[model samples]
Target chain A: MSTRFSPILICGAATLFSACESSTTTGGGVSDAQSSDAQSSDAQASDTQASDSGDGSSDGDDGGLQDASAEDVVDGDDVYAAEDALPSDDVPVVAEDVQARTDIEFPSDVDEDSVTDTESPDITETDVPGVDAGGPDVDFADVDPGDVDPGDVDPGDVVPGDFDPGDDVQTTKGPQLGEPCDLSIQTWCGDEAVPTLSCEYIEAEWVWTEYNENGLPCFCHPASSPGPAICAVPGFVGIDQSGRDRQAPSLRALRRAARLV
Target chain B: MADALTIDFDRSGIIDPVFAHFAIPVPTLDVPPLSGVVRDAAVRIWVDRARSEYVGVMIVRKLHGLLVDLNAPMDLQELALRMLLDEQRHANLCSAVVGALGGDSGVTFDVPELQQPRSAATLESQLIEMLVGTYACGEVVAHTLLRHVVKALPKSGFRLVLQSIAKDEVLHARFGPTLLASIRAGEQASWIDCPGDAVISALYSAQCRWMLGRDVVDARDVRLFEDDEQARAMCSVGVSEPRAFKAAYMAAVERVRRHARSR
Candidate 1:
């Protein structure tokens, strides 16, 4: 599970952290009102990601923040735009890549312990959108921290980065039937090598009718019944010896006939 | 006058049979010859017993196939072969009983077709279906119904014969779960994914067909011994009352479900 960090995520986190610091220094400390405003900014940044990818724009340095205000902008729209630009021939962004990227980038701020206690809670509460957007790599270390709200990015709207097609392909084989059975059609043809028996889908079900080399129904049993329809009398000594008509005689009538009543 | 039909066990190779131990002196009925009602009831029992024995033959054949296909142990195959012999004796005994009642066990139905491998996705699935259909549901219900019958019958030659059959059936009933357990343990997978609902439905279908004698006796022509005592007696001899059979069948299904879950 390789994690590919988007430059947009780092720049956005740095810009959001800078804004928190500036707001705290100017306002004396982070307040309830300030936290609420930050959440609103996060929501706007998410909207920016959504619109950039939705409209098929080009992946550039801008984080699709043209429509969003400075206080509520995040980077990463270009990543999505570049992902969208790929000729529609390739496989869609794999879910694992997006998840891995989001996991690595979103928790970085928390791991560095850069924000104050009041600021940390607000940043931690921010919702980062999980997106897979492909774009040229940009250096976050060289970029200036601008006023942007990382929390505003919706994980869902984030464009996924490039994914290796072969990584997730599973090679294990599922269990095979003894015979070549088509589950959808409900027909079974025995292995070609042996070809001892074959069944046909008849009467809305499958039955093992004997088959020869030519695949014709053969007489398997002594009784001449082919399908379930052929009715034959069961061998019963009582019925054979009685030679009496089939009739339901009442117990009372039987007792009377036997002189027991 | 109808001469009493005697069963020669020596010819059947069931020397000193278990039934002989419980045998009571055969009673001489001074009553007139068997009436139509008695004859009908006796014939029904005889037919049911015959069908059950025939099914035993099919089970043995299926078991042999399973042994080859699954590489099942020799013990299981041997037990199945033994059951075949028991079923044969049971069929003959039933025929003799029918004759004793002054009726002949005639050719009423054809030898049952070897059960088509049930509709399933895999060979394992087919084996599970057959195992449950025949043993878990079929034999278990048979044993339950037969136990009730054995209890209702008075100590007599008829009861002795039934008891003998029931004894073998009880052992046959255990084979299904035992084999299933072995397969599950060996294969390292639950081969029979029998849901509670499916188990109930399968049991209900098999038991209802058995109770009504759907394949053996024409539904319209089948006789019900309306009288309470008569119906109970009929059930004792394997002609089950529909309601009683349903209750017993449901109980057996529940037991199977519990056993499955426990494993």
Candidate 2:
């Protein structure tokens, strides 16, 4: 398509340059014969240059002359002779290329006359050529919304690998040793009401019971028992066999017990 | 009377004794005769020393029992036994000094009855309570008082005796905490928990009474001197003033409190 339009485009460019030169020389002090000679020499030079570069054919020579007349008509009436020269099959291609070039080169030439000529329905029909070249129009609005199932967007529908709801659940352990225990709060207390026994509170009255086999204070209970009992000394409380007490241990006695002295 | 009184140091029952090497030459009966106040004070100091020594004996016995009960590996038993001998020596030394000062009757206090273990809970608690009360509180207070006395007294046989006893008391004071540390580091760590506030409170109260002699109502009657000058003199020779003793007692209590908190 570009091959057939190259010669015509070249001829038109040459003719426009020649017309511009002739218009510039028309009011000069040169005589009419000299002016005509200069104009004929310039036109012949433009035609030769157009033929050499446009198509390498004799048709470019006549095309250049016709182009000059077309330029005169266009200057007076604002029209292009290249559109008439274009073949029917190549008309849309050539018009598109020309329109594109005009838009790029002379974007600021949007006079009312140019807009009316370039923006006509006939020029818009040329856009169909692009579609005919295999660029299909996609109408997203025609797609059925029902084809996409709404369940696909549901979070529960997606299954993540290695995910087990039970694995996230944690089992709580009961209160550890030495932790304070509350009788009311059974959860942390577990099976026992009190976490551990303390010497602050005496659970039972200490009595002077018979001695056990270990010869310890076996006051009321055995020596290993864990409860309050009267120690051998008056006004003293302690476990029978444990040797633990609320009072300070007598160092003098301990020395004797160890039999150091 | 002989020119110089000869003490029967050999009969004191300290085998291969440390103080045996010293040739203690007793002074004349009097450059000035022993006054009533000085005599009373001297007798009292000796009596208290004897009683404290006896208590020392009992403390070791309790420690031995505790070690056995807990099956603790540290054999404080032997050290405790040795401390018993040292206390006995201290008691005799105080008594001898009392005799030289004109209190010939020697330590007038009766043999104290055996005190039962007061910690009626676990064996570990009992051991801890005993250690805090005896070593941290009792012996520490004794060491402070004796140290002051040793500093106040002039360089004499009496000061030497108090110094010797004070040195032993300091070791006795350290025994408790050392044993506790060992227990904590060993398998018995579970048993050695920080004592609750109530136990510490009871222990502190007991320590204050023991240190200040508040537990014994007649302790004031044993004052070594009547006047300030005489009291100062007594303080110089291992008899602490009542106010100073109380202050030292309170300090010991605070120490024990801090020790408990750290645990």
Candidate 3:
């Protein structure tokens, strides 16, 4: 959040058009073009921040403009790279970054219709694990659910924690990332402290066995499952069954906790 | 079917019960259904899960609605249609899935009641026009939560479906800013001002902390923002730049605030 860099919605715009190629290659081209784009993006970043800065130049001082390092200038997406900040050994190696760092110049003039607007003509191909398998069955064994620590076990699983109908509850299953969840197939795991009862169970016992047949791992909370999986976590239902049922309040509380609200 | 409880509404109805029924847990795995005190715990857990999904659906629907329909330069209109189709399918799929889980289908849109009828020619009068504060705040929360869901879910048959959905969203998040920038460009020179940014910032701040709590295990562990391929594909989308995404959100909020204040 603190990084100071130009803000442009890169999506194939500058990349496909080759608009800035001339600016970066010519003498002082890189700085001029970058500085100009920086100014444009900065102005758009926020009216408030731009106003407060008095002069937008205050932001460029943060080291975004330092000579390019091993990191390739990822054109469209404005990646946040600390100026002169040495690349870490662990981050995944990018093909673009292989080149040695240099003080490359960018184009000074803005050509709206330039070919650089859209980078490469075709979308780049990248590899995804299990995407190619294309098999009907999922490779569950390939997934590493990671080490589950017992210390952080939630008590709500064992005993519904202090239930407050009006209290805002956070749901673990909200559309947090970007996709919709098929609630029917979503697998539920009770809190580690109390692992019992789930939507899957209902399917297995009273409903359909297809849910259990899928054999998905249970990750009640987020930040656990990295692989493609639909995790269902059991929630607490308030005892009040009348008008303004406790379920509504309890559900609201979970959504609040998850920040889905 | 004998014990089924049905409730019908003449006007609009709240979706809490629909969500709660889905939240109720029945248990999975090879373990036998727990009885006595354990049974109590299990039931509680089940309800909570149902509740979470219920909340998640609402957020997803609203966020999707905002992102897919913004006016833009490129194939946004086409993209918007595609997104709407996808969302409508999603809504149908969600309804079917929830119904299968014993949850009732209680969702209904009353936009006609909320606003005066606007013809296709008067699209500008639409009440649901993407509001900057709502879009920024909802999506801030949505992006973070979806990321967490993606990380939390593992590879399984069900997960495959989720993965497909998540993959689609990665693209959706990419445009959040491009659309905002377009709006900002138009508003900067216009007579009508944009929205105040502070409200959007406040919403984003809340969403950020909420995301941290949901995704982060300890202070040391930073959840990978994007998986290897997701990161690459997202990076390629030029619009997927998080920095620009942030800027777009900020600018949008400012425009909304300004516009609202002027109104």
Candidate 4:
């Protein structure tokens, strides 16, 4: 199943070049391609505070959390490692599992293209958990649906990966983490060249495009296609989906393979 | 050879396909030699971490089941399934780390019975709450701690293993927000109010206890091993002390808060 080079890969390639051209300063100081401030500051501060902080400290405040430079241990740069030398699209997929998937024969009546999540039939079952263990903390009854403010956990509160390029976009008033999106091909977030795919509903009807500011991609459930889906890009995170080709990009978002240069 | 899960399973004769997949090659895993107290402590710390990752298999399996059975959403089920694999991969890496640290990689791994919180609630409510705890709050805890640990260690095989785990964790940590965003405006609001923001506070507390200890009344203030000396020592060799964990936690908490308030 050799697909054409996905634009997401192209985008990653472009970003990779840009990231390299501008990755000269391994110091704590911000670089040109530093996408998100929160993540950069967060990474810098964590590295600093962890080294400086002993157990004597009571709280993890920004009090002693100074932005320490990386020049001390700047012997090697992981930026390239993060880009090329790290894992390929050959992520994790059991060979037997892929073989089993290849053997599946959909019903004769099933129209693969026309089918959406709601109409799609439930496929064979994989390993699942039986709810034998018992527990409870908050009763849903206490959380009055009608009275509760629309604001719960703000999607903005989502702490993006330490080096997520998306955070740079997300910080600029992007959709909250759980905001609704659609599968229609015509729409691009603010940027025409999106990073990867995102979700409309939580179930399986998904496509992959760039993770633009418009659609951040929602979580998944009842996925239309289910199996071990892993993609292996030449220079980027493996970007393939079991069902929709675009799904690889969405999963890539889940991987958020940050550039740890 | 010292992996706890594989220790009991015979590798001879017809083997399972899943186990075969564990043979995939990872890059930059050259384990640096360790000695003295640092070696002793690194072994101890990594062994405990491996066991924790071992338990993670159960946790991910349970979470995957919850997502599928509840029919929460399409992509989430897929995400959980991928997460299932990621958890196993992390366990594998951690076991490898334990071996490199001079300890037997085969620690006492336990498969504690899975506890389904909000057992009395509707499947919808349970799914929402669990997502908050498991991905949002819980992964946040894991990511923060791991990131802190990764920062403390130099470039070594141990660091590479932890860094790989961190890559997956960072994504999982962001799942909470994405899930919550979907829930807020979805159709289920008619029957269920929201996924419950308090889910973060409640689930985070529960996670702190699970990771640190049972007596951790407040995650914000709890010290690792209940001793500062042990905590500081652990921080040096890539095993964060309790205070270090708290620092990352606070940072994670603030990230979520800032994003929330950004609007």
Write down the TM-score of every candidate: 0.39, 0.41, 0.28, 0.43
**Candidate 4, A1-261: lDDT as tens digits:** 111212222224223223322221111111211221111101111121122232212113221111122211112322211111111221223343342221111223222222111100000111011111123222222222222221232222222224233554332223334444322221222222222333233454323233422221111111101110111100001101111100112222222444333
**TM accuracy, model 2:** 0.41
**What DockQ, between 0 and 1, does each candidate earn?**
0.01, 0.00, 0.02, 0.02
lDDT (Cα, tens digit) per residue for candidate 2, span B1-263: 01111122224445453333321222222213446776665565555555446444444555655665565654354455445545544555555556666555322211112232223356666666666566545554454445434433444345445544544553454455444444444535644654544454444333332222222212343343457777655654445454444443344434443334333
Give one digit per residue, the lDDT tens place, for model 1 in B1-263: 11111122123334464433322212222222444665576566565566546545544555545544554555555555545544554665666665566665452322223231212134454455445546654565455455444434443445445545554553455555445544534442432333333333332232222222222232212345556655555544445444443344344434433333222
Compose the digit string of candidate 2's lDDT tens values, residues A1-261.
111112122222222224323322211222221111111101011111111121101112121111222221112222211222211221121232231121111112323123111100111111111101111212212322223322223211221223233421211122222333221111111111111122110133212222111111222111212211211111011011111112222333333454564
Q: Write the per-residue lDDT of candidate 4 for residues B1-263, one digit (tens) a residue.
A: 11011121112344677544433223233434433555665665555555456455545555666665555566555555555555555665566656655566345421111111113345565466456545544555455555455555544445556655665553455455445555654544543456444443433333322222111112211333365554444444456444444445444444332223222
Which whole-number lDDT from 0 to 100 does residue B150 have in model 1? Answer: 40
> In order, what are the TM-scores of chain A for the candidates?
0.13, 0.12, 0.20, 0.15
- Model 2 misplacement above 4 A: A1-261, B1-32, B104-112, B115-122, B185-229, B232-237
Candidate 1: segments with Cα more than 4 A from true spot: A1-261, B1-33, B111-123, B187-224, B228-243, B254-263
lDDT (C-alpha) at residue B229 in model 2 = 71
Root-mean-square deviation of every model: 36.5, 55.7, 25.0, 24.0
Give the poorly placed runs of model 4, Cα more than 4 Å off.
A1-76, A80-261, B1-33, B109-118, B187-246, B250-263
lDDT of each: 0.33, 0.33, 0.24, 0.35
Ranking by lDDT: 4, 2, 1, 3
Candidate 2 Cα lDDT to native: 0.33
Model 1 residue A43 CA deviation (Å) reads 76
Q: Provide the global lDDT of candidate 1 against the true structure.
A: 0.33
